[model samples]
Target: MKAGDRIRTVLLAGGSGTRLWPLSRRHCPKQFIRLLDETLFQQAYRRARLHSSPDEIVIVTGSAYEFLVKNQIEELGEEVLHDQVLLEPCGRNTLPAIAWGMRRFADDPDHPVVVYPTDHLIGDGMAPVVLQSVPLAEECLVTFGVVPDRPHTGYGYIKPGDALQNGYRVAAFHEKPDSASAEQHIRDGALWNAGIFLMTPRLFFEECQKYAPEIAEASLPGEYSLLPSISVDYGLLERSGRVAVVPLTVPWSDLGTFAALHDASRQDQFNNVGDAHLFDTSGCTFIHPEGKRVAAVGVSDLVVIDTDDALLVCSSGATERVREVVEELDALHDPTVLEHRLVYRPWGSYLVLEESRFFKIKRITVKPGASLSLQQHHHRSEHWVVVSGCANVWIDGETRLLPQGESTFVRAGAVHRLENRGQIPLEMIEVQIGEYLAEDDIVRFDDRYGR
Candidate 1:
C-alpha cells in the first residue's frame, strides 16, 4: 500500500431474503431483523468501519429501504451522510448495485474499494485480513474465499491457481453444485466464495465495460432500469482475467436459509436452537418473535417458525425450498409476504391489532420529537385515545395537547396530524371506520418523512 492510497467499503443492503421467510419480508429484510440483540446490518456497518472511515463507507440499497438502513445505522451511534448512501430506484441485482456504488469514487480512480453484503455473518479481526489485499488491488480484482469447514452444497466454490503474496489467481468460479460435486470440489481444495471483493474503481469499471457494457453504460447515467439483473460473479469476475482470491480464515456464513441459520446458531442440550420452551423436541429448531411458548412432543430434525400471520413447519433439509412457499404467497397476493403485523414507519411504528370489513384497530407509537404526516383520509374517519405520554394532535389546522386518557376524533376529509414533542414515546389507540381501509386511502398535504 502507498501513502496516499485510499480504501472505501461498500455495503450492499438490497436483498429481499426469501429463504428466511416469515421472519424476513419484502418491506423488512433479514439484515434489519434482530437475530440477536444487534442486527446483521449493524454488524456489517461495524465491520466496514474497521476497514474504512464512516464517510468512506457507502451503502447501496433500494429507495424503499433507505429509512430502515439509516435507522439501523443511527442505532450504532453513527451518522450517515447523504453522499454516503446511494438509493437505487429499484432492485437491479448485484452488478448494477456495485457499479452505482463504485461511481461515487470516480474522481479517485486509484482508491481501492471493498464490497460486503449486509446480510452475511462474519467474525471479527477482519480488518487486518481485508487490508492485506490493498497492495494487490492495483493489478487484480481481489475476492475473499473462505476456508470451507464442510462440503456444503449451498455456496459457490472458487478454485485458486498461481499463488500471489497474500492470495491466488482465480482459476475458476463454480456455481452451487450437488452433494457429489461439492465433495469433489472440497477434495480439490476449492474455497467457498464469500462474495466479498476488493478492487480499484478503474479496474472494476474497465472489467464491467469489457464484459457487461450494458450495465456499465446504464450505471454512468444512473439508468439502472434498462440494465439486466445479473450477479457480479457471472457478469464480471468469471469473465475477467484479472480476478484473484484471498483466503479468509475468519468465521463466516451467508445465512441464506433456515438450515444455514441452524448451523450458525447456538444449540442447547437437545441440539435445538431458539427462545421457545421445548418438551421432547430433539435436533429441532424453533423460532418465534413474540416470545410465545411452543412445546413440541417427539418432534425431531424439524424446523418450526411461527409469525403473526403465518406458520412454517418443515424438515431441516427442506428450508432451502422455502422460496416455493413465498412464490405461492405472492401468487395469492398475501399481505404477509409484503409486511408483518407490526409495520415500521419513519416516525415510529404501528401494530395491526384487529381489522374487519368496516373497522380497523391499531396501536400506534410515535417516537419522542417525531411527528406524523399532515394528511387526511378520503374514505375514513379516525378516533384516537391517548394511552400514555402526550400527543400534539392537529385536526383541520387546529392543534391541541391531549394527555393520557384523553380522546379526540377526526372526521373524513379533515386534515390532521399527530406529533410527540415530549421526552417519552407517545402511545395511542386508533380506531378507523371506513368503507375502504387500505393504505392508499391517505391524502397527504405535507409529510416530514417525504411519504
Candidate 2:
C-alpha cells in the first residue's frame, strides 16, 4: 500500500480521565482541557492530520462527547469535507472502538489506519516522524515506542528484538510494573509503550479475528450487545505475532495525572506550572480560576486544582491515586464528579452560578454565529439577561433583538431559540424557576450542532 493510498487516522477519545480530578470530570475530560491553549485532542488531531487527510481521519467518541468532538474538529477547520466524528452509544473500551472504526473502513482493503489516543502529549515536529513510519506500516502492525526517560511505573513497556527497515520487531509488551521491575526494564533498554498503532483496516480486523475473536464477532453491525469491555492492548497487540515497534526519541508524556501534567506543562521561574495565581511557590502545579488567587508559600511538589465547586490538593507524586476520590464521589452519587459547575453543550456553555429549590442561576456563553436549538421546556420558565454581544431571540412566535444588559423571558412550555448575531461571544445570565430544572426536560426541534 502506498503512503497516500493506505494511510488513514483513527482518534480514540472516549476516556473519562478521572485521575485529573477537579480539572477533569466525566463530561469534560483531559483531552478537552486547554493545557497551554491547545487541547490534547486538538494536538492529537493535528498530529494525525500530518500523516493522513481529513477524509481519512476517524474519531471514535462517546455519545456525551459527540458535540465536543464536533466542535473541536470545527475549530481545527476540518469539518468542511469529511464529518469524521463517529459517535459511540457508550464506551466499551479500545477494542470495540477500534473494531468499529476499522469496520467502517473495511470496504477499502488498501487503507491502513493509524490509531491514536487523543490525550497523549508528543514531541514537537512529529509530522516527519509519522511520515517516515508510513512505509513500515504496510508490512506489520507498527507501534510507536517512546525512549524511556525514566523508570516510570505509570506507563507500559515495549521490548524490541531484531531491527526492521524503519522500525524493530516487537519482542514483547510489558504491563505497568512494580518500581523494581520498571527500573530494571529501563536499564534493559525497554521503551515506554505509547499506545500508537499503525495497521491496515483489513489487517486490524484480521488480527482481531485470529487473536480476539470475541471482538471480531462483536464488530458486526448491530452486534454491540455481546461486546466485552476490553482494551486493544490485551485483545490484539499482546497476542499478535505480526507486531513491530518504532522507537521514538521524542519528549512524550501521557498527561493522565496531575503529576504527569506538572511534568509535561511548561514551568515558570519559581518552577510553578499552569494558570493558577501563585505566591512564593517553588515547585507546585496549580490550575486555578482567572480571578481566584492561590497562595502557596514554602510548598513544593504539590498539585492544586480549584474549580467552581471542588478543590483538590495533593502531592505531585500521589496524583495517580486521585481516581479514588472520583470513585468515592461516584459512590455518594455526587454530580460534581460527573460534571463541573460549568457544563458544555453543542450550541453553547452554561455555568450554574447559584441554585435553590425553586430557582437556578446560570451564566451561558454562546459562540458567535451559533444558535441554540428550537426547543421548549415543560416544567421551567427562563429569564435571559444579555451580558455582552447581541442576541436574536425567538419566543413563542415572537422575535426580538436583544443587546447587552437587555433581558427577555420565556414562559414554561414556550418555544425559543437564542442566537448569536454579533461578531463576538454572546454572554448571558440565565435564571430558571419552576417545579423542575433539568437538562432532559427540553424537546429540541432544529439543532445546528446536531444534538
Top lDDT hit: 1
Number of colliding residue pairs in each model: 0, 0
What are the clashing pairs of model 1?
none
Which runs of model 1 end up more than 4 angstroms from their true locations?
2-6, 219-221
Per-residue lDDT of candidate 2, residues 1-451 (tens digit): 5544436788999898899878888988989888767899999988887777788888888888987887887888867355467777767888898888887787785566788899888887556666677778777888999998788888999999899987898888899999999999888779999888888776777788998787787744366646888888888889988888988988888888888888787899987887665666778888888877667666788888888899899887789999999999999999888888988887778899999888999999999888999999999999999999999999988999999999999999999999998899999999999988978899998887666
lDDT of 2 at 185: 89
| Clashing residue pairs in candidate 2 (N, C-alpha, C atoms within 3 angstroms) | none
- Lowest-lDDT window of 10 residues in candidate 1? 217-226
The alpha-carbon root-mean-square deviation between model 2 and the true structure, to one decimal in Å, is 2.3
Candidate 2 Cα misplacement greater than 4 A, ranges? 1-6, 80-83, 217-221, 274-281, 421-424, 445-450
Score candidate 1 by lDDT.
0.89
For model 1, residues 1-451, the per-residue Cα lDDT tens digits are 6623457988999999999999999999899898756888999999888768898998998888888988888779899787777888878789889998898887888889999999999988667777778888889999999999998998999999999878999999999999999999989889999999999899999998999988777734357777888999999999999999999999899988998889889999989988777787888888986658778877899999998778999999899999999999999999999898888888888999999999999999999999999998999999999999999999987889999999999999999999999999999999999999998898888998777
Candidate closest to the true structure, highest TM-score: 1
